[model samples]
Target: MNFVHNITAIFIFAPFLAFIILLFLSRKKLKRGAIGFSADITTFLLFLSVPVSVEALWGVNISFAVSVTAILMAMILLVLEWKKTKEIEILKYVRKTWRLYFLLLAAGYVIIWLTGLALTVISF
Candidate 1:
């Protein structure tokens, strides 16, 4: 159970790790489009993990409904990012505004985390 909890913690914090990596890369002079695309992939993966965590820790007290909501939003964002990646203007804009990408990702992560934590505690 401790192992499972550790794994869940890792899954939960993975987005923050990705955000830090993206931030560091951007600071190191990576291309904007590349950074934006990377951030998109990272964020999508982060959202995808929510469902997996819920399922794997089924008996654990976590906000399953919130995880579902995050997954839905994640899918939508993934599609939008995919489409944006195909358009020159949008891709350029995304690349140039990579920091905004990080900020959005951070915001999403915090919201989902807090919502799940709150709901889980309340369930008990």
Candidate 2:
């Protein structure tokens, strides 16, 4: 249990490592390995962002903040899709939502890392 907990903590702290590992591990098994593991990588990044934000003094319980943001974006995208196409396609919308959510979380994580570095350097 402790080993699993520690491994989880390490992955959350260094998420790129997890992504790299996944890419390599999946490459042989998956035809489009890197793309195939995107959702999994996004999840690792989302979890990473929550802790990074908290440590950077950006927000508390940031997973809730991001989850709401992702859902809101998904709803807005779905509405736009409905308006443009005159119908809602669940599977397509879900893929778009996943990509959107991944981009959002990745950007947030980078911002948090920069802010954390700045905080450390300036003692603020």
Candidate 3:
């Protein structure tokens, strides 16, 4: 049990490992081999960041913050798509949503890491 927990912790903290693993799986099996896999990786990284934010004293309701951001992004995209084509294609909407999520999460991950690092250093 402890071993499993340690492994999970490693993945949570070092998400590059997850990205590499995803790259391999996508190339070897899925054969898509594009940047599509990054969306999943960043999503995991962002959601996992809630705990890190709490530890860094920057978040009391980090989960809610993340959720609301994602919802707002989707709504904005949905509105723009509707205006452009007078329709919302579900597949395209879904794809754009996740890709946008990937960018947002990646940015948030960097900011959160920097904030946490700064706070920790200042405390010491």
lDDT winner among the candidates? 3
| TM-score, every prediction | 0.41, 0.82, 0.78
With a 3 Å backbone cut-off (N, CA, C), the pairs that clash in candidate 2 are none
RMSD of each: 7.6, 2.4, 2.5
Residues 1-124, model 2: lDDT tens digits: 9999998877777666777788877787785856648455656566555556675475566666666776788789988999999977898778777777666666767787787888899995
Model 2 lDDT, residue 23, Cα: 80
Runs in model 2 lying further than 4 Å from the true structure: 44-48, 55-59
lDDT of 2 at 53: 62
| lDDT agreement with native, every candidate | 0.59, 0.72, 0.74
**Candidate with the larger TM-score of 1 and 2:** 2
- Model 1: lDDT to the true structure: 0.59
Residue pairs in collision within model 1: 32-95
The parts of candidate 1 lying over 4 Å away from their true place are 1-13, 31-38, 56-109
Tens digits of lDDT, candidate 3, 21-98: 777767766677435775566567757765565655664667777788789989998999999999789998888898
Q: Give candidate 2's whole-model lDDT.
A: 0.72
Q: Give the candidate number with the greatest TM-score.
A: 2
Better of 1 and 3 by lDDT: 3
